[model samples]
Target chain A: MPKVTRYDAPRVIDSGSIWILVAAPTIWAVHFLLSYWVAAVYCAKSGSGWLGGLTDPRWIIVGLGGLSIAAIVWLGMIAVRRYGGVFVVLEEITDSSEQGRERFIGHVALLLCALSAVAIVFTVIPGLVFDRC
Target chain B: MRRGTSILFGVLFLTALGGCDGRHNWMAGAGEEAAAIGDLFLILMVGAAVIWSLVVGAAVYAHRRRAHPGLEREARLFVIWGGVVFPVLLIGALLVWGLFLLKGITADEGDLTVRVDGERWWWRVTYETPTGDVVTANEIRLPQGRTALFRLTADDVIHAFWVPALGGKMDMVPGRETTLALTPKKLGNWGGLCAEFCGGAHALMRFDAVVMAPDAFETWLAREAETAQVAADDPGFQVFLDEGCGACHTIRGTQAAGPVGPDLTHLAGREKLGAGLYEMTPEHMARWITDTHAMKPDIDMPPYPHLSGPRLDTLVDFLMRLE
Candidate 1:
């Protein structure tokens, strides 16, 4: 029999970790929309009203945001309808076998570490290269 | 309740941090306000990032050490907090910031004016000088300390006007007019290129934006506006007019009324010839007159294959002396 960590709402909610992935698409969408608005203003001001024909970034943001939210919501709905069994099976298997849990945690940690490294490069490298110019 | 709210707030804060660009300088010129607006939106993104990191950090902490039975109940609260409250707040703030930026950019009363037209593979820059003279050329020049208003349009396909140091890009679409504004504060030449891929030689369609002091620009304007006067009896000068070379080019004075190509009224005074391919030297002028296609391949200007030997030398001499 698989072990269940009770049906405590607080424990389940506090233990769930989806914010990082969620934030990626959300932040990018906002950035895209903002860029679109900025570029649109320039185009409109350019006195060449024909720029209105090009595809604006706002539409992309909306489409991406809608898709991401829908996917997350759908996943959450499936997880709930399956009565915690959706993740319980995977977690129980990993927890019972130390090597399995280590492997899973190690994979996630490595991915996060790589992402953090990339973010730092993107954030800091431009300043170093363009500061004098 | 507290943990749930903290997670939501954490996520927003993380977003705000991620969107920051440390190299952002102050918005200085005409189209600079748009950058300022972009900065505000970035602030919102940073806020979101901060919130995300904090929320995820707390969640991980809770997962590792909090073995309490009520965790699932807490998860419901956290979800509601993030899924509903956080998005509502985040989007509301974004909307407000976006509106503010939009207003700043759209405020009327531009200080300068310009007209940019994109052809098949080149840019046509027209500056309407204060003295009622409209100077048209491939390169863009601006007098420092003055706002340059740009009216962008395309003669063929779409092309984007971009000068990274000055401002963001605006597209030039066919059959329509788009307006952009820029005020080049510094006194130096800037590189400008077409951001859109138009056709063959698109990469070669480059232009230099010469930003000069106000006095220097005025002096240049005075010289540019002067009539090109050839001494009445110069044989080589007559050859220039008679060879039909004047038919496709313009000289401020004399009978060269052609507007099919670049204005050569003050071509001798420009820093480069053949659309920035060669230097402004007498030898380069002769070579260009002898074989323009060899220097700038695919140029619209036809090569003077017939003007060779003495004819080429005399024509180069006459053109070089036009200044």
Candidate 2:
């Protein structure tokens, strides 16, 4: 949004849809479901945990959590660069331009990434908490 | 305080203390695991109290302060420290402690092994000895100070075997076997129960966990191993055999060898009948024979209404002599 003094000024901007808002939490939601479901189904099939050298649900959940956190971090970097994702201060953008809207979206997405990362950690904690199902 | 009021207070205090002796009291600390669990519960309670006090104190201190601009940074630090860092550290520590506790309690080895199979409304118990498996029912008698490992499973449905005073509960899955270890420190009868609701008689399904002296337990096990001594010409034994009771019940050392129900070889020896629902006595036995559902609703055993008067008495006498 630099000063356009001439009529023939060139500009390029992101034309992505609003789906970016849900992308971060979607990872968290999928992780949450898969974590509990995997644990439950495995425990049901194998009975009590601590099976001798078998598939451990704890490590599986940990790996899933690590992947989720990594994905959130990548999204977070994008959000911070575009929207100034300081996280502590949330100032409203009143500009109705496309850039302003994109910035707002990016800011919201950044906050969501943080929230989702925290939520994913919470989900992973239960995986560590239980010794057996 | 007035004398009457003091007396009332004393009575209430004594009554509260009396609640500690109940068979299913997890706080009784009768077993090694229960004692450990009790200690964990105490630690958790104390930790929670301490955390609550600290948080409240912080909140009060913050509330009483003046609203200066300089206080904003301090307030943010307070929120982050008290709200975020403190809880994460405390809960993480507790979780680690609990995981270790769980590891310590869930043992893989024991001095003796007892296999318990959960039936619809009863328990079929078998003690694994070097000679062979000594089958029994309803009542589980373990030697005090020795760890008794229980291999538990269910016949048709899922049931949770919980002797609260002894240790943590484990589920009895139909196709899968779960193991639990109980090392009773005290010689007493701790109540065991079916914590999971399986069917109509789920509430009635229970067992007597009797922890005895080591020598006494050995003697009891020896006596229990022997088959019931059934005389050839006993009229009561004749009534038991004639009434088809042998089809569903087993009296070892005799022709009545049925594996469908609880073993009745030492039925009278058990303190409780109908799976710990009633006292093991002649009156209860007679009633149980005539109307099985009256003692425990929705049991698999059918009532014998026609076999009344002398016939029922003879059968009851034969069963009572099983001790």
Candidate 3:
């Protein structure tokens, strides 16, 4: 009998949950597009930079980014529960069982979440910096 | 092998240093904004060099050392500090600095304003005076120590205004007006150009940003605003009219008032001819009229290959005297 730690202690593993791999990046992409759209529309509409230079649109982008990051964090939590720990110590995820596949998906998804979070942060920077079009 | 590598790097460094000189050097520090930009570039270069050295040095050190048991804690600390935090901080600081620099250089207002319209292969320059607008062509003269806001536009396709020694490039889009400000610190003919490729003669389109003393600039402007002193019975003036040159060219205070080409009321007074292509001499001026395509290909100016001998010589002579 295995002395199971909570890392591997899962009740019912979803057999094919590969959508988690793309979830974080998808959120990042959506946030990036929306951020750009908001800024472009704002600048184009008001040439003089009136109404305080993308202030309203910038806050909207911040809210969207916050929501996206939160969603990614939630996805990351799900990945962590199955894969174990923040650090991916696993060299390779070649496990073939239902649990093995779930672990493999979790491993890649966690990395994607970290990358997406970093990308989202970078996207928010230009909005904060530039005061005008 | 190490000696050879060092020699190779030395040669590369020297070669890179060679680009620091000449007229088109953006790091010339001829203007206040240009100097600020030059400082930013220097900082960026230094930071990059430092970062590269650290990364390579770490790799070399790790390579030379024997991997024994574990320095896991130290390694983790190194990764977090060197890999994550350092890059984040460096990029964040640089981004902020760059944004501020951009904001500073892109100031809309200035001590004075000059509007320049970019044509197919030339610049139509207009200086605002207290009396009225003083229009000129090709050459852009700026007063030293005074910030000149440039309102730029294009007649046909897209073009770009750039005085490399003074400041950055700004686009001149058709039907749109973009503004750039340049304050000259040095009194010299720092070369100006049309940066964006427009057509066949795009590369040939050039000008001189002549920084003059404020008083001299005022006197020059006053002179430029006045019309040319064309003699009523000048033979060259008669030839210019007979040849139908007035249909495309304008010589103010004369009957040859064609608002199509450059305002040649004081063409010879300018430093260069053929849109800053040749020296403003009789020889270049004569060639420009007869063999226009030879000097600058694909130009709108029709070549006067038929007109030659004394007629062409007289016309060139008359143009040179307008100064």
Local accuracy of candidate 1 as per-residue lDDT tens digits, B1-323: 99999999999999877654221222323235445644775786898799889989988998899477657666666776776557755665566556555443433335556687887556666666577665556667778767677788898789887665566467889977766666666666565677888777677666666778878987776776677778767677777787787887877667778867777766766666765445678789877776877777666777777777777677777777765
Predicted candidate 2 versus true structure: per-residue lDDT over B1-323, tens digit per residue:
69999999999999998887799899989999999889989998998899889889867986997778766777677776777777767776777777667765566679999999999989999999999999999999999999998889899999999999999788999987788888999889999999999999899899999999999999999999999998987889898888888898899988888889889999999999999888999999999988888888988788988888888888888889999
In terms of DockQ, the best-performing candidate is: 3
Q: Candidate 3 lDDT, tens digit per residue, B4-47? A: 99999999999999988776778888888888888998988998
Model-by-model DockQ, in order: 0.02, 0.20, 0.21
User: Highest TM-score: which candidate?
Assistant: 3
Name the DockQ score for candidate 3. 0.21
Tens digit per residue, CA lDDT, model 3, A78-129: 8878554244542456778777777777887888898899889878876676
**Which tens-of-lDDT digit does each residue in A1-133 have in candidate 1?**
6566657334322223334334433443554455456455645654554544454434433454455445444434433332231322112334545445444433343333333333332333222222111
Candidate 3: interface RMSD equals: 3.6
Fraction of the true interface contacts (Cα pairs closer than 8 Å across chains) found in each model: 0.00, 0.07, 0.14
TM-score of each: 0.57, 0.81, 0.84
List A-chain TM-scores for all predictions.
Answer: 0.29, 0.76, 0.73
